[model samples]
Every structure is written in structure tokens, then in C-alpha cells.
Target chain A: MTARLGPLFEACGAQHRAALIGYLPAGYPTVDGSRALLQAMLDGGCDLVEVGVPYSDPVLDGPTIQAAAEAALRGGVRLRDVLSVVESIAAAGGRAVVMTYWNPVHRYGVDAFARDLAAAGGLGVITPDLIPDEAQDWLIAAQKHDLDRIFLVAPSSTDQRLASTAAATCGFLYASSLMGVTGARDVVSSTAAELVGRAREYAPGLPIGVGLGVRNSAQAAEVASFADAVIVGSAFVTAAGAGTSGVRALAADLATGVRRPAPQPA
Target chain B: MVGIQPVESSTAVPDARGHFGRYGGRFVPEALIKALDQLTEVYTEARSDPEFTARLNGLLADYTGRPSPITEVPRLSEHAGGALIVLKREDLNHTGSHKINNVLGQALLTQRMGKPRVIAETGAGQHGVATATACALLGLQCVVYMGEVDTERQALNVARMRLLGAEVIPVKTGSRTLKDAINEALRDWVTNVDTTHYLLGTVAGPHPFPVMVRDFHRVIGLEARAQMLARYGRLPDAVAACVGGGSNAIGIFHPFIDDPSVRLVGFEAAGDGVDTGRHAATLFAGEPGMLHGALSYLLQDSDGQTIETHSISAGLDYPGVGPEHSWLKDTGRAEYRPITDAQAMDAFQLLSRTEGIIPAIESAHAVAGALTLGAELGPGALLLVNLSGRGDKDVDTAVKWFDLLEDK
Candidate 1:
């Protein structure tokens, strides 16, 4: 339930740090290999693991993540494969969430998908394309199944939408830092700070997680200063291509960045 | 067939969330939702404004040549066992295809919205050329994304688009085909939603696009229906058109959908044959899946990854059909058939020689289907077919296929 995710963020908040969330496609390279990589991320101190459900058309993904998803899809990854990964993460005592575009879930059946994901011990799902206004079926299904429905709030979203999206989201709100698709950037956008600030006005109790271009430790630390969670996706996916050791190294580095101490006042 | 009533109202479609029965919806990223919503609102207002309609109608009439005549081909009819075959000459439109109809309307909308740049994705480059021409006329910056393979196969169209002052981007990802081009265009739209308008070319995509594009081309059916009535004092026994994304077919079919007596037939390109597992026959062989922001019938593997589709005609070489076509198929309001590449080519050459009219390979699929239907209905049966485009773009491919250049 939503209460389960709160403790993880609360634990990080107690340490004066943001939660380190690492993402990797469910069947990257191979399904079993991806599970090993996910375990490495958790071992390296990622607070949460987001297992991507590879889709045919990932409109919101940048080239790096898109290539990884295409490879996973080519390798014959399906909803069942993703669920198996979730089960593995849960068994290892790591909180796992499914990040996917809405179509695959729609095709898989909403209520059935929610029930299966819950049974597999998935905390929730992050539907990148599903907005609060059009999320009635998902809302009902998530409520009935007691699963968290994470919604995305963009820089382009209006205040009314921000409020609605924050209100509807059961888990933390996903705040897209940039206007563009997911990728690593040299500098975090100035708008990300503004978006996080605005999200606070709308959803006071909800934690805001910033994603889309958080690459290195420096960028992660910068975002960690103003956000509750630093989501590193493409960087981890790129590291995943190298092997499990590469994933562990990147995850540890990012985890350290989220825990970096604030500057002492002069 | 199910006993669903034939759709009588044209505006009944797409509700608020853009569902044509169980088919269309906004299955795009959150980044593009605002743009889609803005487009839906602007299009709703633009459709009702007399000034907007006047400008669009004037341009359609004076610039693109509206009311393209219906030409009855008795000579070609001979091959069909004496069925009276009439062609709606959409090929006569400016840019040599029915693609211009949808672009012109969207381009007008772009200008009204104060957007200075327009982006589009194309398969065979007809839609790209059409978009380029509209952008050029409207003094807006134009960019077209096309598959790398399509650029090579349709080099002349690539040249035409560039000549029209549009930038042609060859996409090299994910099979390097229409589907990839669409993904790239969508990415561009999400990044540049403020200054750019994505001029979609067919009756597909997320919400208002399917309804808006279909309305823009509905003139094809309206004009053809009136002309057919005026000429023969009644509607044709059947109306047929090729189905790529189903724009041309929907355009010609919508006006006649209410008339149950008039059968609506759509011909899909079966690259080899449907049974061979290499074709673009989405309605015939595909199951419901999501692609390009719409949940419709698509050629996908068991895991739901889109499968590569094949067709000799680049325009018809797509794995997904428009959501409306899927709805029509499910409702049994329209019937769809598969026309193999060989059958389409046979009809292409037969029409060119018999009637001195070279049809686009995409349209030839419809012609091929009409021939079979004509034979089944026997003599005195009247058939109306939408000649969607000219074959000038396919001449090179034709020469290679028939080995016409080998003699030289």
C-alpha cells in the first residue's frame, strides 16, 4: 500500500538524504541477467528498484533507454517476465515498481494486471502516458487491488492538473525535470526546481521524485537538494549494458550522492 | 457478421477520450497531452467557424482542385466481367494524391494557432510532399521524418520534399520504417510543442487527429456520392478503396456508411499473401494492440512487440491500421479483404494499359479487390473505387518489377 513506500522515503529523510531510485529494463540482455543486475543495484544501496516493462513504442524514452527496451523486447520479454522480476526483487526484500507505458497494461487487462502485479509483490506501477483525468479505470483497479498508482507531473502541466495529479497519485509524484524525453543532461534544468516548488504547494504531504536527465553523482546531488527522490534511469541502463559490476558501481556512486551532506553555514 | 447498425451519424465517433468503439485513445506520453488537448480544442472551434471553412474551401477549390470528377471506365470494366467500374479521381488533386486534403486543413490550423514550424512523418513520401507543399504555401518552416529505407526507395519524393524547402530527416531506428518515423516525429513534437505543429497525415494517432483528418477527407465521399447519384440516379452497389492507414478508404466510406444497401469494402495490401505471414493486412491477420498512440489492430508478436510488415507499395507497408477502420471491421459496417502484391500489380498494369490511367500501387490494391467483387456480383453491378493517388512516384519501382528497363 501507499504506507509501505512512505517508510523508505521517511528513512532517507531521517538521514537528511533523498531516496536513490535506480531503473533498468525487466529483460535487458536476458531476463535472468536483468534480475542479477537489479539485485546488484539493491546490494549497492538503491532505496527502490524500478523494473521497466519493455514496450514496442516507447515514445517518452531517449535513445539509450529506447535501445535497451528494443533489445529487451527482441529477446521476447513479456508481462509475465516483468512480473517474475518483481517477484525476485520482492523476495530479496527490495521494494520494486513497474515503469511502463499504458498500452501494454491496457492490452493485458487492467483489473487482472493490478491483481497479478499485487500478487507478485509489486508496490505499484508508473504509467508515463496515463494522466489523472483519463485514469478512471486504473484508479478503480488500483483501489480495489490496494496498489499504488504513481502519476507523472510535467513542467507543462497547469496548476489545476498538478493538484489533480498529486491528489490522485497514491505513491510519490514523478516530476519530470525537463520538457524533453528521458536522457542524461550536462546541467539539470532550472525549471526542475521551480516544478518541485510548485508541486509542494499542490500536494503538501506527497513526496516529489525528479527524473529525466539525472546522470552523474553531481547531478544526483544537485537534484537531491530540492527533491525527495533522485531517479537515475538511462545512466543505470547504460551501465547495465556493461555488466552487473558496472550497475553496482553506478548505483553505489548515486546512492552516495543522494546522501551527500549539505554545506555548513558560513 | 454482427447485427450492429450501420453508423448513420458522422459526428458520433471519438467521444471525449477519442474512442471509436474500443479502438482510439490518447495513449501518448504525458509530455504530449497538452498539445493534443490544444489541438482538439482548436479543431473543434475551427470546424464551426465560417471564415475558417471559407478559407479552407477556397484553397481546396482554387488551389488543390476540389470535386475531382468521377470517371467511369467501361474499357477496364470489360476485364471485370462487365461490371460498371467508376473511379473517384483523388489522384487529380494537387500533389497527385488524397494526402493533400488532410494536410491543407491541418496547415490552415497551424497558421491560425500561430505556430511557425510544422513536422510530419511519412512512409512513401506522398504525405511528406503534401505537408511540405502546404508549409511552403503558408510560409512556415517544415521538417519531415522518413525511414532510411523509404528515402532510398522513394528518392524522387525525397528530392521533391527538399525542393519544396523542407528538411528531410532519414530515421534509422527500429526497422527504419513508417513506425520509426512516427516515433521520431512524436519525440520532436514533445520537445518542441510550443513552436511546432505535428501535421499528421492520416486518420490515426491519439484523439482528435483521427476524427479531424477523417473530416478533412470526407469530401471525397460526399463529392463521389453526389456525382454517382447524379450520373446513375442511385448509389453504387459497392464502394471500394485501398487501406494503408485507412484515410482514403475512410474518406470515401464515411459518407456512404449509413446506406446499408451500398457495401463498403477496404482492400489491405498482402505483400506476399496473408497465409505467408508477410503482409500489411492488419484487419485480416492482426490482433488488437497499441501502436502510435492508438489501441487498434496491429501486427504484433505474442509478447506484443510490433512485427515488421511487408508490402510492395511503400504507402501500404504498415503494421497498424487506423482505429476507426478497426471499429468498422468489428461492427461489420465495412468489409476488408486482402489483395496480394501480385494481384495489385496485375490490376496496376491492366488499368494503365486499358484506361490510359496509371494508378498508384496503393490504389491498385483497391482496383484488384474491385475486380474480384465485380466478377462475384456479375454483370450490371456498379462499383465505385477511390483512385487515391497517381503512380508517378512508383514508376521506378514498376520498371524494376516488370523489367521494363531491361529491354533498353
Candidate 2:
């Protein structure tokens, strides 16, 4: 699994395009429904998919994702159900990762979670709340299981923190485009480019995926100009609410946007 | 009765990574790590600085009224089968609760950190009112996030906060309760880490918060111990307090931890009853899980999803308890019991009628537990209960519960 992310990014780089990453809470609305939605996202051109493990309290999520998570939880989705969703996505040849808060993983036992997630064919995990400094248990577990550990870098992160976080991260650096919770915005903050640039200085050649506000195709194209991956969550969650077809259509549109040539310097 | 003696050590809690023996830690986003570090550094410095301690103590004395008296409730104890009951009068504080102690301390820390604004999350509104009062006194901008449902149930407190110049935001998100409000406050802190302070109200969040808030309220036990000794020449056999997020319990229990003869007890709200699955008895009926940045005993289902808790008292209707309390329970240093809503309400009215002291429904849980404990002890047992807050805010709830407002 640790060997999967590099090739995914390199392949996108060869195509002169940014990888399109879509997010959906596992078992949202229903487990089967969510699995099908994730497959639709991949079918519609998403290079990678993030299956969110719904937590009771998601501090970093906005209302859209929070609602989705609540619905998933209401549907009785557990960690095993999440791993099953990832398994289905992997069996279908879709590159999938589990994005979750740290507590669920901690409660599930870090080593057990890593072993099970790897067994389910998960490429890596995106821990929105777990920082590298306090993630020693997870660090050791992920390394032991040969699973990728993706860490988030916020706009507020100091240089020292960014370097340490990047050093510990396995797959890619998740650069939050803004300082606020995860949600869509009409305008992607200019801070995303600055953050990506800063992360690059500390972790040269590492893939930086910009998330937290990239909503539309235009915003995706704008972020794709500098970021190695355009990670959109709330927008996809909003679309997934309508149907799997909606998720597929949005993924296709976002995929095209990421591939569009960066606007010639005006 | 055991004689009161000064506890040997003051700060043994929260090892380097903030774990109270595998319970607490900085399980937060990367964005908040720097803020937590800065807070820990400032708190460490403030803890040792004479000027800081003096200023905080002065404010605690002059503004909030420290050294709250302990009252022996013999009339109430008569109903407890001959046992003597003493009440730690935290309810007599200026802001009407023990929460003021923690808010004032954090507000001072906010000023020391040079932050101009503070954000908090509230459930029953006592913490919100206390935070608003402190922020007003210190001239700091205050924003409080409350669950939309809580805002409606605790309308007076919402108005009180607004009157004190704090902005009250009704969060209409998940569960629409304390947990959601905390989520919003954390988001705000992460977004405005440079200029704002998240003045957490309870001893449940990540490191520094649990330890810092506990230190602020430890004065409760310290003062109570001295007062008990000065008055009765001995320590009470048992100390009890209501546990929502376990602030008041920890406050009164910390100083007595070394007193081997003194039994520390915490009463959690059992909304209907633990058997009915509608209760907030996290330590009693809950399993270990993580929420709001700390791994603690939480009311969760088989899938690790947090179960919505119920209590007549909005303050105690939370699914999680403080991590330190979890550590205490596991170490056999403390015992936690569940009190049903009916039992707590019965004690609420009983205290009012017998002693003319209107206890908050939250505190009444402890009062109810003390009654059972007193009866079990048979006779001559001395129990000190922390009257955590006044019942003024719960009058409407009481009136409705007993149908006092019905045309009579």
C-alpha cells in the first residue's frame, strides 16, 4: 500500500494533470448505496476516493459532511462496515483510502486498525486530527503493516511542524486550503498556493493535495494549477445526497477541470 | 472522622503527552497542536509565576468570592436516617456556580496570552454565563456556541450571555447539543488561532485544559478541607459531587485523594435510568471511547457511535465524562454511581423544603446519592456534598415538573 500513492501521482504528472480525489462518508444513506456512489465516482474519472468513517463528533467537518456522517452513523455504520466499503472499492479496481478522526482509530486499536485496513486493501489513511508528534502508536503500527499514513498540514502550521509532519507522512501531504473546517466555498483561498509552496520547500517532490474548500470545476482547475491533487469533499457529499449518478457527473466534471490547462498567464 | 492533612504533592496528573494513564492526550487536528503547545507553555509559566498567581487569587477573592462556606444541613440530614450532611457552598459564588472559578482562570490566561477574543461551548448555560461574565470583566470579546435545542431550553442563560455582551450562536448541527457546540468552537479556534482563545468549560478536552481547569477549581477542595478542619476538627468520611463533565467532582475530589479514609464518590445523571438507555452515566454505564479530543468513558453503542444522552438537567445531559475521572475510577481511587432523574428531582425539592436551599438539578444528583449513602451507613456518617450551583436557572424546570404552574 505504501508503494501505491507515488505511482498514482506520477501517472497524473505524466498526463500533465492533477489527480481528482473525491470524498464520501462510508455507509451514508446506506452502506450499499455509499459503496455504489464511491464506485460511480471512480467510474466517472476520480483518480482516488476517500471513504470517510463517520464519527460522532467531527470537529473539522462542516454541516454537509457532518450531516452525511450523522446519517451514516444513524444507519449503524461501524469501522468494519467502513473497511468493507473500502474492500468493495478495491475489489472494483478503485484506489481508496479511509479518512477519519483519530479517536475511532485509537479506540479500534492502532495496530488492529492498520492490519484490518491493509487486509481490506486500503492504500492509506488520512487522519484529519492526528498530528505526527502525537501519532507514535499509529506511526509504528502503519509502518509495521506497510500502510501509508497521510497527515494534514494546515495554513496555521509552523515551518518546524510542516517539516516534521511531512517527514512522517507516507503517501502525500494533505494541505488544508484554508484555516477553517471542511466545506465548499465560492472562492478557493489564495492561501492554498502559499501553503502548497511552503510544504514543497520542506518536503520537495512530495505530492500535496489541497482540500477544505475546492468545490466547483473552476475552483478545482484553479487549485490544480499548483497542487498535485485537488481533494474535494463537501461538494461530492452534497452531490452524493442526490444519487450515485450525481456523484459520477460531478466527478467527471472535476476530473475534466483538473486536466484543463492552467490558464495562460494573463 | 479523619483529621484533615495537607496533600503531599499538588500536580501528579497528565504525564508528558497529557495522558492520565492512557486516558487523555492531544488527540486534535494538526492546526491546533501549535495552539495547544503555546497554551501549555503559557500555563506552565503562569503556574509558577507569583505575579500571575497573586493576580488570579486577588480576582478570585474580590470578584467571584472565594472561600465559600460549608453549611451543615442537619434538617436535610434528618431525612437521611441520622447521618450528618455538610454542603460545600459552591452555589454561593457570585456567578451562582463553581464554573466561575474555571472561567475566571481561563479568562486571565487568555489575557496573559494576549488574545483579544475568546470562544466557548455551553450545554446548560451556566458555563456560558460564567464565561460571559469573566470576559465582560476582562474586556475580551466573547462568543459562545450553544446547541439550538439547548438555546431554547436554556433561553434565560442565552439572554444572560447576550446581556453580558457575549455573542450566542445556536448551532443547528449534529444532535444539536453540547457536543456539536464544542465542534463549532474547536473549528472557530482552529480558524482564528492567532487572535482567539477557546476557553473550554469542562475538564474533558485535550491536555492542559483538563489539568488547567482542574487546578483552578482545586481551590474548592483546599478551602473546604480547611473549613471542615477549622469547624469540625476532622475530614468528612466521604465527599460527593455531581459529574457531568466531572469538573466539580474533580475539584472537590483532588485534594482528598491522599486521604485514604475519605471515600470520593461521583453521581452521574441517569435521565430515566441506566436500564432504560436514557441516561448520562458515562462512567457508570459507558465504555472507554474518545470524544472532544480526549479518550474517556463515553456513552456509545456497539459500533462506537456516540449515543445521545438524556437528563432533566441540561448540564448533565452529556455522553462523555472527564478523562481524569476515568483514570480515577480505573485506579479504585474514586467510585461513581448513577442517580435517576426521578431520584434527583425528589432530592431537588427535598433540599428546598428541608433546608430552604434550592439546589440545581445537576447538583441534586449528588444530594440524592448522599441520601442513599447516608442510609447505607446507618448512622453517624459524615458526608460532604459539593453544591455545585444554585437552582435559580432550574426553577422553571421544577415548576413544570411538579406542575407548580398549573392552575391550582
Candidate 3:
């Protein structure tokens, strides 16, 4: 089983920057091509990698990710194949985790999936659909397998909800600044800084990462100014259309964005 | 292994956490939880309020046409080997289907929630039209997401929705089917939840939805049971309905679950056949998996991806069913069987010819099942089938299938 992701976040803290996290679907474009994409994210300076397990019905995702997932499914990606990508991500020295909707993992046997993910050296899982309210089976399995169970909080979260959600999370908290699905937007919402501020009150010790529309470096810098980590998803998927080099180049740019100094308050 | 036995208990299921014996729960993104909790809270309060109950019952009685008649099919009984066949005529309801019952209740809930707009996803467009009907009467803006393929197949319904002042968006993603439409609707809900009420169209979906939608449609079984007792003096030998998302099936089946003498049979749509891997017979062939916010029997590939489903009846072309149906199947309280397109179409034609009742293809699946079941039960057995909808919305598809329209 792989250890928790605590040390990696601590290292990023010491470096005085929000960690650069990049996301890509496993078995997208093609089986081998996806492996190249993961390597590119790490090579291009992503501090951590979130390998998405493409699901058939992704309600929380927009068109781009859904198209990529559909293509991945057409290419016959399986749960076992996804684990191999996670294994490669860990072996390449980048922090590794998986992002998937809950059903596939539950169908694979919750305990068995956690055990397998740990064996693959993946640190944790980001479940978009499996909220803390209905995570009893998952919580037990995660504990037994020594895996982190990261939960998400949106801008819509109430204070009580924020506290409860933060209390249940094991690794860093994933805070989607927007209430909408994943996609590249023209401008980032300003609500994220406030959401992160509330989360900081509820979970001061845990690192908080923001996602759900971090497309370019400017948006990345804006988010990183307050957040502990900057997570990019659908934008990276769009870049992968130009192949692995496109992904590497974008990852490098976002990494630089995370390192850029915050604009001072007036 | 724990020895499997039929759990003969109360039909009152989907407890507070919305679990129908581990089959139903809130499997949704965090952003939707607050709204779900609020819905649960509001629905619970409404249920206990006399004014709310009275007003909704009043709408069901007057506007939606409640206590739909029990029509006997004497000529149709000949095909069932002289066995008696009667129907709960939900086909006679306002908007021509049982779908009106749930939509009216949800539309009322939407008004209560102070949401000015409603969004829904539909397959055959029965629920979409029904939602549009309710929204028009109640003065709420309506938008329905339908699969691109279904919108083309059931074009009249799209026109009907548009005429009723609802915007119909054709979803072009994920095999262009009902499940894809649901995904699109959820995305809309995630983004515009504050101003919009989802008004989910079936007995399937996350937490309170399976329970809430079922309660709304429970009137079908409740009234049918009473009507049968008052008119016929006995319960049915068997009660049958088609299972799509299992809304209409569970609606009628729920009232009869405690009656052990009554056999509950839900017929699923088997397009070519279940063996052909082109069918929507989830309980017959699928494994336990979560899809569309509930853990139920879903037709999925080995890797747990939902597979595309095929059925002559667009209403029954869904990969997943209500979670309560999963519990009923697991507990042996109800049995599900598959009826192929040919059998359903044959029954559809027979009912039209023999009884002058043009049933929906979805309901035709149930009629086909009743014919086989009546033969097995023999001469004196009483069978009650819930004719879920009228065939008006299906005329175009039927015209193509039967080649009735002339090219002259």
C-alpha cells in the first residue's frame, strides 16, 4: 500500500508555492498514448498527477471530458489498465492519485479496489459523486487499505457542511470554486478565494486545492495566490488533442503560474 | 453464503437515509447535497401538512383526473385462455399517461420551493410533456433535455413540449439516449440549481428522488386497490406493469406487496432478446451497480460502464431501474420477466383490435406478460395490468413498425 500524500504537500509548503496538480484520463487517445500523457504531466513539472478512471456516465463533467472518456471506453480501457497507469505515475516519481466517479470502483468491490489502488502506489482517490454522507462502505475500505479518501467542497457548501466534509477527508481537501461541471472558461470566478477562506477556517491544518476551471497560467496564478494547490483538468484534456508535448507544455506553464507571486491586496 | 430468503416485511422502504435495503442512497456530487437535503426537508414537511396534501389531492382529482377507471377486457381475455383481464386505466389520465401524477406533484413542489424554472430529462417524452403540462398550468418555465435520437424518433412530443412553452434541448452525447439526457440535466442542475428545480421524471435517481417520485405515483396502486375491492370484492391473482425505470411498475406494485396472494410481475423490454445483448432487462441480466445516483441492477460492461440499451418502446430503453425494484427482486417480493419487441408489438396490435384500446408500447410489454401469465394461472385467475400510457405519442414509431401509412 502506498503512504499518504502529506509529505508532498509539506514540501510544496516549504517551497512557498501552491502545488501544481495535473489531470488526465487513463487509456485516452489510446492505451500507450495515455501513458505518454501521464509521463508528460510529470516531466513538464506537475507536482502531483490525478489519473482519471473514465466512466461511462459522467454527470459531473462537461463535453470535453465526456468525449475523451467515451473515446477511452471505445478503446477498451479497463480498471486493471487504469491501475497500470497509476503504477507508472508513482514509479516516475510524481505524486499519484486517481479521480473517478464512485460506481466503477464500487462495482469492482470497494475493498478490492482500494487494496489494488494502494498496491499500485496511488496515494488516494478523488470521488466526484461519492459524497461523505453516503461513504460508509468506502470510508471503512479506505481505512483498512491505508488509502486517503479525499472529499470535495463546492462554493455552495454551508458552514456546517464545510466542517463536516473537512472532518471526513483524509488527505488535502478538493474545493471546486465553481458550482458547475469541469470545463475551460474565459475567466475564473472570484468566489474561490472566499470559499478557500471559509475552508481555511474549518480545516486550517489540511491543505486546500481549487479546481473546476483552471485552464491557462493566468487563471492558475490567480487561484494559486490563495489556494494551497492549483488543479487543472479539462484544459489539460484539450491540450492532449495536440498530443503529449501539448500536455507537457501546458503543465510547465501552469507550474510556473503556481510559482508566480500573488498580486498584493489594495 | 447467507441463505437467501424472501423478506416478507413492510413495503415502507427507503428509510431516512434513502436506502431501500442498500439499494438506494445519495450518490451525487457535493454541490447537489444541500438542495437534496432541502428537498427532503420540504417534502417531509409537505407530506405531513393537511393543506399541502389537500391541494395536491385536489389537483390529482380535478386537473390530472384521479381514480382512473378499471376497464375489463372481455374480448382480450380469449387470447389469455379465458382468464379474466382487467386494467387500471392510467392511459385515461390527463396528458394520456400515469406520468401526470408525478409531474403535478413535483410541479407543486417546485412552486413551493419558490423556483421559477423546471428542467427535466426524458426518453419517450411522456414525462417531458407531462412536466410541460404541469408547468404551464402552474406558471413555471420548463426546459426538457431529450436525447437527439429520441427527439427525432418522437418528434411530435418535442412539438408538444414547445407548444406548451417548454424548451427542448436535444442531447447529442453518450449514445444519444435517455441516460445521456439525464447526464445533461444533472449538469444543468449543478450549474443552475438555485433558480431551477430538476423535477426528475422517474422512480430512479439519487436518494429522496426514488422515494419521492414513488410516493407521487403511489396513487395509481392506492386507487386501483380500492377500486378493485369496492367493485370486484377480491384482490388480483397477479398484478402486472412494464418496468422502464420501474416508476409505473413500482407505483402499482407497492400497494399490493403486502398482499402475498397477489403476484407482482414487472415485464422489461427485451429489444431483440436478452440473449442478443441488445435489451433493457436489467433485473433479468444486469449486476448490482450504481448509476444515475442510485445503486441498482444496471446493464453495464464488465468494467462497470453503462451500456447502450435497445427497445422498441423508447420509454423502456433505459439501462438502470429504480433502486426499490432492486430490493423487491432481491427479496423475492416481486418477479421480473422480459418481453421482446415482437411480443410487445403483437400484444399492442391485439389489444387495439380486440378491445379498441391502443396502449403505449411500454404498456404493451405488460399486456404481453399478462397473456403468458394468465395461461399459466388458468381459467378463473384474475389479472390486473396497469396500462401505463396511451399510444398517441407512439403513433409515428408504430406507423414505421407496422407499415400502416401508405406512400400513395
By lDDT, who's the top model here? 3
Q: Output the better candidate (1/3) by lDDT.
A: 3
DockQ of 1: 0.61
- Model 2: residues >4 Å from true position, as ranges? A261-266, B1-11
Model 3 chain B: ten consecutive residues of lowest lDDT: B1-10
Write candidate 3's Cα lDDT for B82-131 as tens digits: 78999999999998899998898888889899999999999999999999
* Residue A35 displacement in candidate 2 (angstroms): 2.2
Model 3 CA deviation exceeding 4 Å by range: A1-3, A264-266, B1-9
Clashing pairs in 1: none
Comparing 1 and 3 by TM-score, which wins?
A: 3
Q: Enumerate the candidates' DockQ scores in order.
A: 0.61, 0.68, 0.86
Q: What TM-scores do the predictions have?
A: 0.96, 0.95, 0.97
i-RMS, every candidate?
Answer: 1.6, 1.5, 0.7
What RMSD, rounded to one decimal, does every model reach? 3.4, 2.7, 3.8
Chain A TM-score relative to the true structure, per candidate: 0.97, 0.97, 0.97
The candidate that achieves the highest TM-score relative to the unseen native structure: 3
Write candidate 2's Cα lDDT for A1-266 as tens digits. 44558889999999999999999999888999999999999998999999999988888888889889988887888899999999999998889999989768877888999999999999899999888867898989988888888999988889999999999998899999988898899988988889999999999878999999887888889889998999999999999877988998999999989998567334
Q: List the residue pairs that clash in candidate 2.
A: none
